[model samples]
Target: MAPTVLRLLLMLLALLPTIGLGNNAAIADTDSTPAELTIANRSIFTFHATFLGETPAARAQRATAVIEEALRGTDELKVSIDPLQNSYLVLLGNRRAFIVSPQDLEVSGGDTRVAAEQAAAVLRQVVDESGEARNLHFLLKAFGLSALATLIFLVLIKGAHLARRKLRGRLPQLMRERARQIRVGQMPLFDMQFVYRIIDRLLSLFYWVVVLLLGYQWLSFVLSQFPYTRPWGESLNVHLLDLLRYLLDGILQAIPGIAVAILIFFIARGISGFSRRVLERMARPGTLNWLTEETLQPTVRLTSLAIWLFALVMAYPYLPGSGTDAFKGLSVLLGLMISLGASSMVGQAAAGLILTYSRTLKTGEYVRVGDNEGTVTEVGMFNTTIRTGLGEVLTLPNSMITGSVTRNYSRAVQGRGYIVDTVVTIGYDTPWRQVEAMLVAAAQRTEGILDTPKPQVFQTGLSDFYPEYRLVAQAVPSEPRPRAELLSLLHANIQDVFNEYGVQIMSPHYLGDPAQEKWVPQDKWYTAPAKGQSADEP
Candidate 1:
């Protein structure tokens, strides 16, 4: 029983120094059984101990507090150890001491005095290391490294500038030589100077990127030099690497979708092109006999646009952010805006489609729409452009054209030649045969009047004072000549024919006949400046 009591006491002594007095009362509350005691900063171990009872815990707590107080002081720390009653004494300078038992030494497999001395030496070393004076050397080293980094950065910038200058001087000529080798139908595919400029910008961007990375690394290194700021440096590096990794992962994940989208784009493009080609071939004069040439191109274009729109809709879900709420909101907003703003555009497109399919008007045709009479130059989705004989180009909205009267003169000119008619009143005294013969002569003399169909004269109306002599002649079928000019020429021939035949054309309100006969004699037909062929000829 006595031996067992001794062993219990020895074990109790060994365990006491490990637990602090502040924590001894809370040992039953704590789940962790602490076997060692370390200073607050955890830079060094103070001693080996255990959680058991009050007496030794109190002694250890007091000694640790004394050691910490001594470390906080300005005086130098000195340690010594000695045997005391089968245990050991660790002396801090000449004032304070801590006890180490044989059981404590046995826990670490060492003699009691040796263990006490070692613990004292560790405490002293820790106290010295905790002093603030030693950080100056590290601070100075950090400054030196920062200065060296700055110098290297400046040197790199200078080298980059020189390299940029050299590349700018020589790259354009080389690009031009290379571009000259790539030709399409005798025209260079790409502009050499433009390509060189693009490459120069990319190279400059690369250099700036390198410079930025170097600066970031230098900054990180400088920050990591101090213990306090080292965590921030580590965090910066970790964040940058994480961001890069995330971006790379996203790119890799999106590659399949991007490939699918590209494939759809190429397929749609090929289909549109092939369909357009087929439509073009069918539009030829003697091909598949489908649509007319005037309608085929517009139909093909509209069909291609519809196909591409459908393709885009199919490809939408595969786009990187198409499923995102922001993308959805943007699409809705855009669609709303378009719906609100495109009323007139819708009307114009509808009219254009109708006009195209109806074949009421065609390009290169002479047509009169409302007050605007001209040759149709362009028929667009929204508008139609016309070039008049007066050299004015008129752009009219398709909606307006659909609402107005469109007189296509070229439509009549397709088969039979266009007929030009003029009416004149004559007195009853003049014979009808003579009047008809004179009108025929005038029609024959007109430059653009067709000869084969011949001119025909009609006495369509008789009034109280005179008879209406309507003379009609065939002109060129919608030939690109001024109608006003042709009318002027025809009128001039009629006047000369009348004046040569001594027939007075002023019979619309003939109250009485003129006394001396208001007629121009045949001899005076070519009078004065009217020097040309005689008007009396057949």
Candidate 2:
């Protein structure tokens, strides 16, 4: 079994010069990620293809052990490269240790020579460092340097911490004292709370960046002090610079995409402005009845939102990383989340649009939706806010406003006012004309009730005992407080006028009839209140 293994090993070595000879494109297509070869924690180089029957990972493992063994030898090891037609022999002290094939070259030209001078340079560094690691004087010197680096790193980090803490405490006080000077009229140019938050965040970012840079320098210095890990230390610095370069390159590449996005948004903004102007022109008296002053703002907002959304959709493909799977997945995830939350929101928004476009509700108009009655303060996408005369503000969902019966009080008046109404039930024995006259007189006594259109009293219902009278009149001053005050005044006057007429305002309810007649006699037919000819009549 041992003899068979030895023969197989020899055969594998002999076959290395002729194996893995495929074209570069084919080898790269086979596996895009190459396998890395490392010594201890230090990376030496990478391999792209299989040699003989060994995979790149397997080849890396074999090369690592052999290289480490060569470095551990006591005798002086002479390292050299032997080039062949299809491979290169990496010799250590006259012994053919490993082979570098056409597949291993970082060659820009054809796979002609073993143009792995980069690999040779890396090997030479390793050999020199291994020898230095054996020196007691160098080890002591490196240890001292590492200790100094660590101490410096800690001191700098602590100083940054104290500086940040002091800044966090004092910056807000400084800003607060100085902010009063930066004001326009009475309004401050900067809200103190917002400025504090901005300052704190900026300080935190700077502090963390300083800490990270200090930590990186410390770690790199410590690693570089050791011979075995010197390559890793160098790699750390190289990789960080490479990452920063990649980021800058990406930013430069995205410039054209950003410019296109900006251009699209600019055009959309112009179109939105144009549409707003057109709507405003159409809002001129008798130009477009549907596009009135009440609806102009919302129409403009919705139009602008739609135009910007369209522009975003058109410019999506040109945005940086928009084609990446990660970007697509994130977009899909966000869409799913929105869809989950938007079920009721979409309905309410639709109802709000319906209320807006249909001219059902407008801000500052008095309205009664179900039991909620107030002036519409805001007709938002999700809710409608109304402020009542009672000094209470109510937020009703747009869906509820659309579903419930809504009565607009402003419709009955020429100018800004609300229709105020009150209901009363009186015995049938009392003439309805007299009752109406009493109500009209009461309305006349009330302040802010318009008399030109004339107050109206309607007999809404006739029950078993009495008739229901509803007195509806328009109240002016166009405010919530005045409307409430007018209703109270009207009710008070109704009682006083009825008392003057010697008429009972209580609704009569009786199971049995009285022996005497309940009707007013003919002699009293020309009574003072009849045909509203009383002293209060104008």
CA-lDDT, candidates in order? 0.74, 0.78
lDDT of 1 by residue, 69-89 (tens): 876677776776655456666
**Which pairs of residues clash in candidate 2, taking residues 3 or more apart in a chain or in different chains?**
none
Give the TM-scores of the predictions, in the order they appear.
0.65, 0.78
What's the distance in Å from true for residue 58, model 2?
Answer: 7.3
RMSD of each: 12.3, 7.6
Model 2: lDDT equals 0.78
Tens-digit lDDT track of model 2 for 1-538: 6434544565565555457543332232225346787665656567766665567787788888888888878988877775654666666665555566666554334442334555666777777888889999999999999999988888999999999999888997799778878989988898899878888998999999989988987888799889977866888899889999999999999999999999998999899999999988988899987888878888899989999999999899889999999999999999999999899879998998899889897887889999988888898988999988777899999999999999998875778778889988777878988999989999998877888678999999988888899999887644445455667788877766776676666543555546654444334444865553444445
Best by TM-score: 2
Cα displacement (Å) at residue 517, model 2: 12
Flag regions of model 2 displaced more than 4 Å.
1-37, 43-69, 83-85, 101-120, 158-182, 185-187, 338-346, 388-392, 444-454, 461-465, 482-502, 505-510, 513-538
Q: Which residues of candidate 1, in runs, are more than 4 Å off?
A: 1-134, 193-197, 200-211, 226-236, 277-290, 414-440, 452-479, 502-538
